[model samples]
Target chain A: MFEHLHAGLLAAVSMSNLIALFFGTFVGIVVGILPGLGPMVGMVVLLPFSFAFSPDVALSLLLGVFCGGYFGGAVPAVLLRTPGVPSSLVTSFDGYPLTQKGEAQTALSAALLGSFGGGVISVVILIFLAPALAHVAASFGPPEYFAVAVFGVVLVVMAFREQFARGIMLLGLGFWFSTVGIDGTTLSERFCFGTLSMQNGLDIVPICLGLFGIGQTLILVERDIMKTNDIKLSRSTLDFSAIVKVLKYWKTLIRSGVIGTFVGLLPGTGSILASFLSYDVAKRLSKEKERFGKGTPEGCLASEAGNNAVPAGAMIPLLTLGIPGDALSAVLLGVFTINGIYPGPLLLVKEPVLISTIYISMLLINVVAFLMLIIWLRPFAMIVKVPGKLLAVVIMVISMIGIYAVNTRLFDAGVAIAMGVLGYILLRMGWPVVTLIMGVVLGEIMENRLRETLSLGDGSLGILFQRPICIFLIVLTSLIILIPFVLDIRKNIRNKKLNQF
Target chain B: MPKKDYYSSRAHDLLGSIFGVFALSMLITSPWQVDTSGPDPFYKGPLIFPLIVFCLMLAGSLPSLWRLFRPSEKSSWYLDGQGKPFKTMVILGLLIIYLAGIIFIGLEVSTWLFLLIALKLVNQDSILKLTLIPVLVTLILFVIFKYFLDIWFPEPLIMEIFLE
Candidate 1:
């Protein structure tokens, strides 16, 4: 392990890797500080270039974007009451209040420090935990793999408890989309419609770019971009004292980081869940609970720490089991497969140096993002003042060009436009979009694995129950589904009784 | 009790109705459209998954479509094209033209013209910004794509007719 780390250090420090780290982090910060454009969009835009670069350089670039996005999201949340990423919405709860109370500098400092601390702890957790998990996962058979996929789907379904049916419906939609291409097991055209493009099936890059990049732009353009011109950052400046002041909440930082890492380990639970969970836990633990929403720096710290830890924590399953936790990691998985680097149990053994380099790169990405934010927090906040329309046009141009540049297929451009339209429609609807995309991403694995398991059992559903892992997953998913459903019924009944009285 | 358009939910319902129609169509047409023949036909059976998907979609959409027709105040009966949709349509039209431009005119001129029109439409009234931003953006795009990455854009259709 130590030898691998040493070799990883050497590879991570190569000029190309360092350049990618800097450039990716820089792009990530800019994207994160901008509303509606998060790390995923930035990563997708950089995806084309990734195909050309070495694995270390490409992974570092995307990793930088992923972690740097979280680090930078807190800026707008702190100063402008606008969270650059959804995960930072929790930050604004306390952060914006601090801004109003003339303590923007302290809020920003605390958020950044918490992010730095969380990032470090997450890497530590990844180092210690991932290998053990990989070792355990090495014994998994098709039944277990099939069970894990189902478990992953259920985990995501449980995440969107508020919109249960819609989440599932969208997931089904994504699954259908995944099945559109030639069947992996059968090599039969399911819905090719006698077209060559349809015969080849859909690629994730174009779909993702269209959905996020183009779709997000269409939404942003409908509003006045210059409306944020009134926001001023004159009084909101950071100092060394702010850092010292933020460190006083070391307890919150550590707790949130651990909570985040644990939650992140759960498949399908992304950074937002981590942030919300950590913030809620901190609120429950704090003696000054009343002060939480009213500019409590600890609240800001917990949320940032929680969200920042997720990328590394999520990387574990991705490295060990080849399962991605969220859209961002799914895209990372896409990149890995495209590069002929399949991440599973064998990955740890086959590419120890590559894996370790990624680990080392993750740690450096956090530090680089932290230092950059500290130095340029002021200029970075200024980005929020840019007109939304201008940014919209920019997304349109780049996404269109980026999609075309990848393989130069005109049909891909058509697919992107169609996807962009679909994405816009989905976004406009109250229906959950993530589930659909996840369905599309994870659907193929579930379909193939489930069919394989069934075929092994001579097409008997009872075969799933024969395996301990599959039985455990089935029971767990049942409980997860049933508990909330029973509780909802009880709540409704109690409400009816109260109305009768 | 008109349902607030929040998140374009009514539009979602409209799409739901469409999905219902899609499911119905697929159920009727799968015999012709889907080809499930292969080795281990049971394992390779493509129809099984689609059947499951079709059932899920119908189950999810039927209730929503029923709700759409029930005349309830909790939802709208029609889709409200929203958020300066006219502007959005115009821009979408411009996007279609831009995409067509890449195939017809070539990458260079198309990008510049598209940017120029798009920047102007977004209310950048300055001649300098309109002119300079396009030139710079086009140059950067050209350099990065053409010179740096060496991607080949579709040749202009006119190249076939003209002696170059």
Candidate 2:
């Protein structure tokens, strides 16, 4: 492995590869910093250009964008209290609080370091464990996949432990939305109501934009536009001390990275779930759990690291199984196919040098992107000082344009506006929108897998119980859901005993 | 002194439950059926998942409706304080107008109008700054999407006239 990595490093050091990496990273960061634009969009926009370059150069460029985009979203999340992408939503829980406390520099540093650590760690994991993990993933049959999907959704609801009921309701709504399109198995339209557009179901992009972007804009508009002068930036640009402080939570960084990689290896579970699950796990492990949503560096670190790890971890499945882990990897799959390099079980056997080059390029791009962000930290931080009213207009315009640009569909823009209104209402009611997103992400997978499992069993429900992996997942899901309630009951009982005394 | 608790009206809860019930009724009554002809004859139709969701929604909303009738202390439904409802309504109204404008007029013209209205609602910026910012933002977006990314938008009446 080390020998291959060395060969890859030698291949990746060419001037053309380096230049492509730099440009891709630059574009990725810019795209990520803008609300409603994510790594998928960045890759999609640049995909045409990939046809012009060699496979190694093209893959390096796209992977650079993928890595940089994940980290770039954290910038807006920490400073502006707006997540540039769905995964960054977890980052903003504590990131925005730190910003409000005038520690935006500290937050940005932690985010960058966490992202860098995650990227490197996941690449390492990908290098060593890709074959083993892919074998495990390949064993996941329909029942196990269904169980995993259920587990992911349950984890999302559990992430909002205080508001589990509300989360469940929102998740149900998300699942319903997912079922709106034509049924894949039965070849029947479900909830289109005769509309051609609705037959395709709701797009995740518009939903995200409506919930996070437009919804946030409405709140800013209602707050009377926060004044730019009110925000005070600290003297330091990239705080080494703050970075050191975050490093103290090395356990959290490592754990979240591991969690992210494992989740990313799952074909359908995306980075959004990975980050949320990581944040939840971090909070559960923290001695100072109360500080989690209130400017805790640990929260930001966990989320940033968890999401940043996904690019490499996602590659594990794409390379070994010919299965893209998520949307971005799906796009990368197309890029690979276009470049005449089909990734499957035989990929490593056939194209060891090319695979190694890709790995080395990823490592270099991750480091370069982090360094560039640190150098440009001050300018990024200064964006928050833009007049809130002006920023609001900018956000709205960008969101509208971004939604429209996705498929050049006016219907998507309308969906975004409608969702924006719904999100605003839900926000006012203190409902968890993140859970809804998770449900949408996992719902189709669960439904389809469940149907497949049932069909395989000839409609016998016992098939789920018969599978060892499914049983294990079911038990894990039950434990995760039940442990909190059990803890709450124990706390209540102890309090009652004390009151008796 | 102990903190005083304020309770909001149960209107939202009532409406939510009503919507759930309505959705459930529609799901039950819908004629669109799933094709179960392929091999698996016993497979429940496509309506099953949606029906399950509506049922869950109904079940979840029931407690909220019950609490509404019982008159318990709750936070206010309004996100901001009094008089902000008007502001929210105005913003939502503008959003609706913007959507309509995008369809009828075009992206550039609609975006310009939306920004001007939205900015005026949110802040008391100078007319020149507001005008310049919106026009520049619209142009930059147009260039990025239309010229660079090759995304298409309906040509506005004004743009058509200018081209002619």
Candidate 3:
């Protein structure tokens, strides 16, 4: 462990990696402070650049943005009462009320410091817990992988159970898209439509850029959301005294960090839920329970710590299990795979140095983002005044050009545009856009493992039942799919009995 | 409770039918799209995996689609109404033209023009924002893409004559 950490410390301090870390985090904070644009869009737009650097640098840049965005998300929530990231909505409950009481500094400071503390704790947990988790995951064979992929998909669909059919249809669409280009197993062309571009298969980066970047821009434009609010921020600065004040709530920080990381460990449960859960618990446990909804530093600390802890916690799953816990981590999976660094049991065994560097880089990013937020708090707060529409337009253009730069391919840009339309249609229809991405990310592993498992069993799925882990995964997936239907049937039966009475 | 769906039931039926038709196409085209000529049986063919997925999708969509058409069932199959598709479509049109513009005109010129028009569309109240922000943004993008990032941009068709 010392050897790996020593190597990580060396790699992390390299001039290029350090620069990438700072740059990615800065961009992350800027985007996170902006309304309607969050880490996912920032990561996708910047994903093309990730290929230019080594995997260590690439992951650092993207992960910096991932963690940094959470730190910055608290700003707009506190100052403007608009959660820059959806997860930061919890922060706003106490954050905004504090701003109204002219205590914005205390609120924002506690939020940032608590975020910093939670982020560090989460990384510590990941550094210790992930390797042990990977040891168990090392035993995961083709059947286990296949079953787990199905479980991941089931979790995502169930998260959007309100539109179950829509989720399945979009998942099917993403799976279909993944099957385009040459089939690796058979070396046979599939779904190319006689186009050379399709022969290479669709890249996840461009599709993400389209969906979250361009497609989201269109939604914002249609809503005319930019014209709705004029953003203004009074002067706010974080001092050492504020940090001292925030540190007084160390218990809240630790508790929320644990809750956040544990929630993040679960697949498909997002940071919003983590923040809310942490806030509820903190409120319930507090002697000043009445102070939660009103302006209180403890409330901001709890919520911010919870949300900030989530990125590292989510990375725990992504880095070890090769399964993303949420949409941001799912995109991060693309970066990992693109660099030929597939995260699984093999990752910990094979690339201990890279893993350690990621841990160190995550820690460095938290420190750097916290300091940057403190020093330039006013500027970041002020940039929030930029109209959402302009940001949308800028993001859309960057997405197109950035995606084109990936391989200098016009076809990728076209794919992005096409997916943008599909994403927009889905979003308008009230379907979650990220479900398609989740399906796409898991599709390859699912297919490859299922095929491998089938060949092992001579084309019989009974092999899945034989494995303990696969059986557990399958049973969980089955329950997820069946429980809603069973409950609805019970409801109907009860209603009929009441009517008869 | 769910918000009263903004879109009427008819629009929702359209969405359901789209999925229904898409599923049907996948099922119909699977045989041709997937080759099964190897020594292996159809189950082992490249088609099996996608086939399984499409079947599951059909299972999900078909029930919903069936219920949509049945008047005796819940007649209020609904959608979260599209907020302003006409506006979004207009932006889409602009984006299509922008892509075309990049192919014909150079990236710098087309981007400047695209941002100018886009800014004007979004913030008609600010003339300076429409005129200046575009130029500033374009300049910044050029510096970053050209020098800092070292990204390659495709030369426009007009540049072909200059090359010759």
Candidate 4:
């Protein structure tokens, strides 16, 4: 394994791959800091380019985007009081407040250093642990995959803190949307409705862009009035002392990284869940819990660690089961397929070098992003100083061109427009687009897995629980779904009694 | 009831009615087809999920509908000092119009035109800044799609003549 790592490191750090790494990380940072354009959109826009390069080069670029994008989310969260992605929502809690108090550099430096620490820890874990995880994942069958999918749906319910009915409704809607394309076994189309585009079902990318980017942008556009009474950021940022302070918070980093890795390993549990859970955990464990929302550095560390650690953690499942762990991983899976490499347990044995190469590349990607963040730190801060309207126009133009550049299909452009509008409406109604997009992204894979599991029996229900892994997952998912509701009910009951006095 | 409660109830009812209408529409317009293949449980297996979703939608919407007709005691809604919900509604309305235009005029033209109109209506900026920024942006997008990324967009009818 050490020998393989040496070889992989040599191959990954070749001049060309390094250049790709730098370029990809730079693009990712820009995309991450820009509102509405998250890593998935960046990946999709760059997916077609993957076809033009070797699989390793492709991974380098996209992985760079994935890693850099996670850290990039902190930029806006700190400076503009806007979270570039849902995962960065926790960042803004303390981040924006810190910015208001004229310590933007301090907040930014802490987030950057925290991101690097959590990311490096997870990468080490990914390196040593991914191979073993692959061994465990090798035992998984269709039933196990289905169970995992079930677990994912349950996690979505927990992660989404909105109305229970609405979340369930969205899940049902996602399942329905998943069934749009052709059936797995029989060469039959279910809801094609005679449209060629619908036959392929909905592409998760356009739908996601429409929902998060377009929809959120419209909401921002509508509520265009600036809310911040004052905007001030100290440009003279010092890192060494700040780094020392953050290093003392290793317990926070480790806890958040573990939480992030666990969430990432779970199919469909993305960084948003990790960050929120980490923030909640940090708050629960902190000495100064009351200071959390009012600009605590611990809050910054937790949120940054939570979001940045996700990509590495998410890569575990994708490399192991070929079941993408998140939206970005799904696109990466597409890149692997396009390159004629199917990622699964077999991939560990057949392409051990490839696996190690990716791990090593991820390590380098973070380093490159760290360096780029340092070089571009001041410019990034200046980015927020631009008027909101100007920023919107720039994002709009980029989105249009990016979408057009990818497929060049007018139909796809139309699809994006439709999706954007639908997304905007869903946002206005307070519907969680993450759940909807998760459904769209994982719909086909889950359906195929479900069909495979169902076919394994004499059509008996016993097949779903026959596998020990499946049974364990089934139990886990059931607990995930019920625990929150039970807690909420208990809290309500206790509160009612307390108020009665 | 207080006058504020009367308006709030009306708003709740309107929301409930909208969902109720949408739910009903799904039941009516869901392209339910007959599967003529072997041992069909119902004529339409495809319709099952949609029908289930519609039923759930109707059921879920009931609380909002009930609140519209009868005031609820358990809930409280807050308003800020200067916030006018009606103004927010109008802004939302303008956004809907801008989104609708994306479908008709295409993304570039629609977005550019929307920004111009939005700036004019909202007094967000001077005409010079608003007008110049849109075209500059449109060109940047054109270069990105056409040159940088090699994405092909259907030139808007206005640009179609000149570019072609």
- Candidate 4: which pairs clash? A405-B151
Where does candidate 3 chain A have its weakest 10-residue lDDT segment?
Answer: A225-234
TM-score of each: 0.95, 0.72, 0.94, 0.78
Model 1: per-residue lDDT, tens digit, A1-501? 999999999999999999999999999999899987789888888887787788889999999999999998999888787888999999999999998887888888889999999999999999989899989888888788888877887788778876665676778778887888687767888788889888767777788777777777877777663246545454434577889988988999999999999888887788998999999999999988999999999999999999999999989888998888887888888788778898888899999999999999999999899899888778888888777787788678777887888778877778888888877777755466777777887778778787878788888778888888779888988898899989999999999999999
- When candidate 3 is compared with the true two-chain complex, its DockQ is 0.58
**Single-chain TM-score of chain A, each candidate:** 0.95, 0.66, 0.96, 0.84
Candidate 1 residue pairs in backbone clash: A225-A388, A428-B7
Quote the lDDT for A269 in model 3: 80
Give the poorly placed runs of model 4, Cα more than 4 Å off: A1-11, A14-20, A31-62, A75-107, A225-256, A266-299, A322-354, A496-501, B1-31, B34-132, B148-164
Q: Distance from true position, residue A384, model 1, in Å?
A: 0.9
| Model 3: CA > 4 A from native | A226-235, A488-501, B1-10, B71-83, B148-150, B161-164
DockQ scores of all models, one per candidate: 0.61, 0.43, 0.58, 0.21
Q: Which ten residues in a row have the lowest lDDT in candidate 2 chain A?
A: A224-233
Model 2 residue B106 lDDT score: 88
lDDT per residue (tens digit) for residues B1-164 in model 4:
45454334344345545666677676676654312243423312344445655676577566666765576675444322223435334444554564455545666777677567655544457767777877776676656555775654443555555667
Q: Where in model 2 is the C-alpha error above 4 Å? A: A1-115, A224-365, A497-501, B1-19, B30-44, B73-85, B157-164
Candidate 2, pairs of clashing residues? none
Our tally of clashes for model 2 stands at 0
- Flag the better candidate by DockQ, 1 or 2: 1
Task: State which candidate, 1 or 2, has the greater TM-score.
Answer: 1
* Cα misplacement distance, residue A12 of candidate 2 (Å): 8.7
